[model samples]
Target chain A: MKRIFKIYTPFINAGMQETATYRVNWVFYILGSVLGCFVSYFIWHAVFLSGSGETMNGFSLPQMIVYIFLIFLTSTMIGSDAAWAVGEEVRDGSIAMRLIKPVSYNATFLFQELGNKLLTEMFLVVPLIAGLEIVRTVIVGRVEFSVVNLLIYLCSCVLAYLINFFFNICFGFLAFVIKYLWGANMMKNCIVGFLSGAIIPLSFLPETLGRIFMLLPFASLNYTPVMIYMGVYQGTELLYYIGLQVFWALFFFGLSKLLWVVSVRRLSVQGG
Target chain B: MKHIRRLFRIHRIFVVQELKRMMEYKGDFIVGVIGFLMVQCSNLLFLWIIFNNIPNLLGWSLNEVVFIYGFSLIPKGIDHLFFDNLWAIGHFTVRKGDFDKYLTRPVNTLVHVLFEKLQIDALGELIMGIALVCVSLPQLQIEWSVFKVLLGIAAVFFATFIFTGIKIITASVAFWKKRSGNIIYMVYMFNDFAKYPVTIYNEVIKNLITYIIPFAFTAYFPALYLLTGENPLYNVGMTVLMSLALMSLGVFVWHRGIRAYESAGS
Candidate 1:
């Protein structure tokens, strides 16, 4: 464990330094996201006002508001764009330098992501969540989140992050073939944003469509974590969703490992 | 007249150069168009899902909402198609000292920058907008006449300038800051607010879109005028007036930024 820790520390430090250099990006990213949140808020508020039901899709107006904000918070914590980073290294032929190093390229990024998130969460993300919680409290008339759910929510977030990171790492492997992944990246973001219920809850979608999406692992990324936080799933049901997250995380991990070996072999053969 | 003709001739030359360059990246272009199409499709899916839960939003039917959404895209896509290179100026041109090349050119600098690239990927947005407007047309309650048609066309044409103007003003900030893509992104994204019924929002946001950024004049106001025939002078006229004001402001800022441009120091 000590040796493992030592191996990852430098990459983590490098990631934090890289992120620190782009402090301005963090601000504008949050601003754009907050604007998206407000747009969702007003649209949903309008929907509630027009509808006769007190609850639609099993969420009250207050719960729906919390759901929207929590989606933003959780997705920010868990979402990965490792594909873009990996694709860039490949494009500039810097992957060869990375390969020569003793470190595991994919594993190092996890530590780097840790470093990136540590800085972001400690400074930007935590403060934003606190501010949102205050807004949520003002809107809902009380601070009502269960403390137990928060603990479990954190655990689920770990698995969700791993799942997302592996998925994007797989996309990064595509850089071996595609050369430019900009369009593919855009498509991935939209599809994931929709499927993961970051834009809207899956329950609000058509029942069959929602069910089909759940059959994939995207819902586990954002939806499952928020639902756990809201205490919508309990006991065995909660365990079931968390187990599903583990399954997807492992599946993507194996797939990415297979791709890494194949791609690296191809790389050496072509380089010679 | 001669100067304008010369500018057009130069613009044509640059466009041909860009088209030749585009042949090398045909696959990327196709993928970009498909990517945009998917985004629009998913957005419409989101809209559909919302309407599934509620009968109407802010007393406006889904078809009416769709009309406004589609109308907003026309101007946005037009601006995206022609002025995408503005993004590079905001993003890295000033930061990397590439702005020096534009200044040294003999042609009008602002015109030169704009004529440098044409992004064909926005064809997806343009086509989707026209498709949505047509799909929603039969259900809308608008009374169409030759005069109204002409007014609508003119409103959309001028509304395109609103997007271009906002992009220019924000992008020109790069001259001083070395990069202003985020500023442009922040301001340009306000157009999303106008894609829906502006009245559905809080008073503050409604006023923000209408007066502060004036993005509402690009879509909701013009759509509202056509749908309900309330006041063309207020809807269509304000759009034209705002476009004129914004463009003059845009050009003034670009010139000011030109004077301020210090190439990024090594």
Candidate 2:
């Protein structure tokens, strides 16, 4: 493990440098996300205001706003362009270079992604959340935050990140056979955007659909952590949610490993 | 007249070449279409889910909202189909110093660049948009008349110009920034706000969409004029005026950008 860390640390540093080089781009990305959150907040605010009741599916206007805010935070941590990077490399026949490396390709990629994620969390997510918290306090008053819930939310967020990474890598492996993954990437984004509750809360979905989404791994992506932070699930239910996240993380990781093997074999057969 | 005819001929040739190239990668083409369709379907599904819970959003029924959503796509699809190469300006061409090629070309640089590539995926959006409009037309209970048909066509035509104009202005920012894709993307995200009734939003958002960015002229205003048949002249007039204003601004910016252009590599 120490040796692996030693090998990957430089790559992570390189990734951090690359991210720093595009600091202006990150500014625009964060700005766009903030604008998106405002738009969503206003839309839901209108809906709640239009209705007779202040709550929709047990989400008050402020809670919904907070939920959107949390979704953006978790999304920044979990969302990685690793799939697109991998897809490009595979399409261009550059995966062979990585395959020839002494280090495991997945480990190098994961470490680099982790480095980028760490930078983004610090520079983008943390500051944005702080700003939003200030706004929330000014507008909606005090928000409930417990140490136990925060700890569990953090753990669930880590699991969500892993699940997302493995899912992206799985899609990246498809580039071995499919020359263009742009379409597949778009479709995957749409599916994940809806099923993962990034665009809308899963609870707002029809009951059967919401239940189905809960069963799927995608629900853990943004929904589970945000819900946990909201204290929607507690006690044994919270434990079960955490367990489900772990199960998905392990499942996707194994599936991606199997896919990598098959894809590498295919590449070798094709003289890649 | 002669220059316009020549430009049209060149555009046709470029489009034909793009189509041939797209056909070479049939799988990619099909997948692109499917991907766009999936995105459109998901958006419609979102609307369905929302409407299932609420009977109306600001007095707009499900069918009415769907009509607006569908109408919004026509202009967006047209812009995507033809002007997608503008994205390359912000993303690659300016950054890589490839804008020099457009300057050297014999044809009008803007025309040549705009027609350089066609996004076939937009055909999927076009099909879906028309299908949605058709499915909702009967339910909308609006009397089909020759004038209304002409008005709708005009609305779509002007809306496409508005979309293209915005894209051009955004892409032209590459002259100053060298890489302005993110800015372009951020600005483009405002189009999402235009998909619903403008009345649903607060005064600030409404004015922002109407006067500042003017996306409401692309969808909501036209749909309002078409559906309710109230203030038809005002809505359609604003659409036309906005289209002309935006297009002129786009051309003006493009010229300024060309003058400001310094190739990337020294």
Interface RMSDs of the predictions, in order, are 1.4, 1.6
Stretches of candidate 2 off by over 4 Å are A138-140, A268-272
Residue A84 error, candidate 1, Å: 1.0
Q: Which candidate gets the maximum DockQ versus the true structure?
A: 1
lDDT of 2 by residue, A123-159 (tens): 7655765676677677776756466766788789999
Q: Just chain B of model 2: what TM-score?
A: 0.97
C-alpha RMSD of candidate 1: 1.8
Q: Which ten contiguous residues of candidate 1 chain A have the minimum total lDDT?
A: A263-272
Show model 1 residue runs off by greater than 4 Å.
A268-272
Question: Which tens-of-lDDT digit does each residue in A54-107 have in candidate 1?
Answer: 999898888888888889888888968699988887777778888888988899
Listed per model in order, the count of residue pairs whose N, CA or C atoms clash below 3 Å is 0, 0
Q: Candidate 1: what is its chain A TM-score?
A: 0.94
lDDT of 1 by residue, B1-266 (tens): 99999999998998899899888999988888888989998989999988887878878999999999999899899989998999999889999998889888898889998899999899889988988999999998678899899999999999999999988999999988889888888887788888999988999999999999999999999999888888999999999999999999999999999889898778
